[model samples]
Target chain A: MIPTIKNSKWLPLCDVPVLDPSSWRQVIVQNVREGDRIAALFGCTHNASVPVRLYALLARDGQGTLSVLCTDVEKDYPSLTPECPQAHWFEREIFEQWNIIPQGHQWLKPIRFHAPYASSTKTSPPIGEADFFQLLGNEIHEVAVGPVHAGVIEPGHFRFQCHGEDVYHLEISLGYQHRAIEHSLIGGPNKRTLPYMETLAGDTTVGHTTAYCQLVESLAGCTVSSPLLRLRAIALECERLANHIGDLGALAGDVGFLPTASFCGRIRGDFLNLTAELCGSRLGRGFIRPGGVAFELDTSAFHGICERLTSVSHDARSAIDLLWNTASVVARFENTGTLSQAAARDLGLVGLAARASGVKIDVRKDFPCGAYADEPFPVQWGEKGDVYSRAYLRWLEILQSIHFIIDKQERFVPNAVQTQIGNLQPSSLAVSLVEGWRGEICHVGLTDDQGKFAHYKIIDPSFHNWFGLAMAMRNQLISDFPLCNKSFNLSYCGHDL
Target chain B: MIKSLWTRLKQHHRTIAFPKQEPRLPEKFRGLPSIVQSRCPKHCSECVTSCPTDAITMKDKQPHWDLGRCLFCPECSRACPHGAVLFTDDYRMATRTRDNLVIGPKEYGLAQPLEDQRRKLFGKSFKLRVVSAGGCNGCEVETNVLETIVFDIGRFGIGVVASPRHADGLIITGPVTHNMKSALEKTYRAVPDPKVVIAVGACAISGGPYIDSPVANNGVGNLLSVDLYIPGCPPHPLTILDGLLRLLGRRYSTSRR
Candidate 1:
């Protein structure tokens, strides 16, 4: 879906007089009715007390599209959850994080924080972790599954409330891996933080770092050259290829297909080799700088990439065909963890997870950023948002990306790298989204009065889809969680941040 | 069964046995930090400005390099008119001493190149463990591939270990994060003492790009005493293999390991 664009020149839909950045007064008080939503689309109220920016989207219409924020609910504020069912989680997150109370609010259970306060919350004083997530009913059976699993994966905890095999209620308790990234950046936020951004999750190094650099470069008013944009796209495509291969192998492995699994894994290594050959580091780290990419792609390396691409593509196709034709693999993946379109949108899911459910919202296609803006490719969408669909969609994307790289490599020519960047104006706020291998990755940055970053929030595709994951798990046999989870392949550290 | 065998036969082995044979590395593959004794610094300040991260500082007229901060892009060598910054084939660059890398012009402590040091350390045999603490999974990916049929590191008795418990040395990637503090420490503790910690990649050697993390008290420096410092966001696969051999004393420690 296209992003609803609204000009901020005129008055905002929000009721509260948008306070200037320096001031903290002018709080408009409004009481929310049982079905009333307070949505704000144009400009959000900056909670001076917290480091976060609050924008409300009240659902005045009965339709799925939410409304704008209506009031500045502080001491005299009212609860909008009674009016809008979707506002339940967003409000809880804000309340627990920034210590803002939605007067007459219903549920306040901790969502991300384990201890309410890992360190000090300069953004917004938290409402204590204890009162953020939903409180389970007495009839609810709480099931805690892991910070560690038997398969190779990052650490995260999943708690399910069920009435037999079907989920009666669900609450996900995250933060077992909160590294206090935002807090840490407060002290030292230069090149050092760039690589740390990569580890927020292993698979998303390219996506996370790209978003982080884009935010920083934008804050610095630095515009990378076109060649650099192409380079970034190529790097992103490479990272995407590696991930898709691993997933293909992993999904196949789940069904006792070891040869395909091993073959795919070995191909992943070759992918890494190709990356290391072009760039000094393996994971495409340091390749992206503030102004543009740090390294350049010359003829020999370009030829090398081309040679590898040709053979790798052929091998991947055959290997995948073998796995797909296998009865066991096909049976395991089909009809597992299905998430309908309605449920997907309600949870604000993006990326392959949502795409499999037929959501046509790719950051690359919807809001093209980087060289993707120039590349000609349609967003890959699935007819069903199930394990099988998501898996197939990833493979399709990988194929498309390979063609993209081959096209670039064939017609590519080197140009001079631009070293200087433009000075950022403090009055602007630029938001760009990248179609990371996971899904749509959004980056938003608030420049300071001095044009430096005042506040930066990187909303990875994983964050908006976690709830959708819980919903997808409903009614599915517990054994299928692995395949289902792999299909979604959400990054735990990506969300924890 | 015949088709399966055909597929296996048709697939080119993915690994490249670097030590027993020569595996091609990129031209400017920044693997680890080692001093180039060929052209000792005569107190020139050119490299000082060339360092983007300021990991280099002069102490008593000597260049004291914190491998934890030095991203071995070979940019320093590029900046040096004398070509004092050399890319030694020495890959096994690791040590228990946090101050292993020499800083300042005169006190560079490079009696020989990194190749010499590797020869000294390994003499012949070495056991290595590669740790990817927050690696982009690039280093880990290639390193894991090292075990495959193409670039087999095990041919030289070097492989990546998931935990530090069974390792004689440690190879790290990515910048050190606060959450990974316990894990890094546990892995280091898991490996027997008198063991070496090799900082791989620009991040591990010196938080390549993500050095400014809030959780990072300072990337590799705060985590452990990095012996060998390799640069590159993800150091080249062959460079990694060469570093392994250098540690086993199979090769010599040139200037840049």
Candidate 2:
């Protein structure tokens, strides 16, 4: 049996098969060995009488199918990381959340410095106080940065074990941006829920909000109108265009290429303004709600929007093309932070980072949903798995997103923007996967008998790709850390949440 | 090099002449809100009930809007049958005091200039160090956008410094989570005496949506004396710029009145 459910479809919670821990391990390890990926691995400790139940959501990209399997454990379970490297972070998160230890795990530490949700009897370790791996050679030294960085950015701690100028390892400790979003989300779809989703990763407003709304719609069995779907897709692509352009500019600035850097900085604002034109906020807040979008794009405004897009598109291409043609920028970016395709696959990297590393996986192409199903675009990718590929892949994807948005808008139809979102179906689970600009954004919701969320697991792409960044830093110059870091552009708040 | 110069000319000088020339926001932009209680029917608590952040409170059947707590969402506006609650296109909602954030269908004081001594000290060449305690990066991004070519806040002699010791003030974002409390305090203490504190976004002012979260406090709340409070889910770059200019006593006609 396939044991799979279609994307965004609700299944009875009781329908999931609960296997023994060994069998669960066998199933996950077997599937992963056969090219499946772990989309969401979390535990729910709702029933106090029963043990903490671990749920594994496995994705088979080529088949466009997802399988769910669960197992009940009292405390420790044999670690899967020994056999399947992709489950490393998920297992650490599971241990942190449920106090269920994964014995024999290679590196066990708190991913986010919070007391275990299963029990709060023990005092949790402080945020940046973990034992980071260190080297004790004659010329080796360690450098620590942040929790309060120099730039106007989010907080997280980075420790580099270096020998002179070369970096041996980079370990990142986060939880500084932890706002307890998931903790506050229990029994929600409340007023706080939409705002939480909107600000989940601030920059990914439309992508994350669309995922949350999809989960709600699936559980409530509400269907979005065609025009609304097109509008949502446009907003999402606008978000991608803005962030990718901004990152490209930052990358250029890092490499001392001033012209493209300066142009991209302003051009990014132009794209954000386009989103602000669609709705009120530049970040696309208040634009997406449960049943549908908050604002509608009028027929009259379409021409002006398309015009603005064309102009911004022209500017973006001109600015980014300079980066490719510049020898200095290309030399700086070429081999600074290389991650092998085999390593990327082992770590289960997703989104642009995965694509840049030559891993042919994209939720939009593999597991199509919403407007993506009707108007699919070719997945843009690179083969080098280095800073150059990551930077270049963003430009490729930006071109695709701009084309996709313009195409969708040209074929735009007018329809009701919102419909009534009914109460969710009781005792069910729904999964939503969105191709956010950063990567795959997975939101899985399990509802109680009263139709309130019992457990809401949000997996931002950063959770999967942060390790990839750390791995990329291996054997690179420590000074190039900022360049590699910006290349990945992982979210601290998104991961800590 | 020729291509670089050509691209530069093609991009043109992208900076806008804001403050001197009135800023142009999109028509759909939601900014400062107003309440017309007279249009409201008796015993209607619809707006209050619809607010996600409890930014609206009904006392004696009158809706009091708290901009500090508001996410600027459309739920309250849509639920108001009387159109009592409406968001104006006015983005100059930053305030000088926390109490001024809560208003009941009346005009409130916008962010006032820093008292004479501090303004004189920072009026020219003001430097700030931004600390993101627990922000969602919305506030941080907009604050960073102020330095971009379009806004070009540096034109006013204000810039972000790498260290707090070199800063004249601190621009804070986030709801001040427990993990970041000590770091925020250390940064605050690092700045010299007579330093200013500007709290940006609804999150920094009133914890915005994360108010009362177990792990996060109500922003900088009473932790530090906040000199200015810029309000929004994430304030627009223009809104933040307006607040800073106002604090420096650099007044200009904000809107096309």
Best-performing candidate as measured by lDDT: 2
lDDT accuracy of residue B71 in candidate 2:
90
lDDT of 1 by residue, B1-257 (tens): 56667777777565644444555655545554555655756588677677756767766655567654665554566577877665554444444344555444433332222345554554444556554444344455545555655665556656555455656666666565444555567667878756777776656765554555544435576657665654444555555565555445555544331
Q: Compare the candidates by DockQ and give the number of the best one.
A: 2
Candidate 2: chain B TM-score equals 0.96
Docking class of 1: incorrect
Worst 10 residues of 1 chain B by lDDT: B105-114
The sequence of per-residue lDDT tens digits that candidate 1 reaches over residues A377-419 is 5877898788889888888998998888888865677763846
Per-candidate DockQ vs. reference: 0.23, 0.87
Error of 2 at B112 (Å): 1.5
A1-497, model 2: which lDDT tens digit per residue?
43687678779988989899999999999999999999999999765667799999999999888999989999999999999999999999998888899998978999888888877697668889987899898889999999899999999999999999999999988989888798899998797899999989999999999999999999999999878888888899999999999999999988889888888889999999999999988999999887788887787786688889998999998998888998989999998899999999999999999999999899899888889889555787899999999999999898988888778666777646699899999888899999999999999999999999988999999999999999999999998998999999999999988
Best TM-score among the predictions, by candidate number = 2
Off by over 4 Å in 2: B252-256
Candidate 2 chain A: minimum summed lDDT over ten consecutive residues — where?
A: A408-417
Q: Which ranges in model 1 have alpha carbons more than 4 Å from their true place?
A: A1-53, A56-93, A102-152, A160-171, A183-202, A212-225, B33-54, B71-91, B101-257
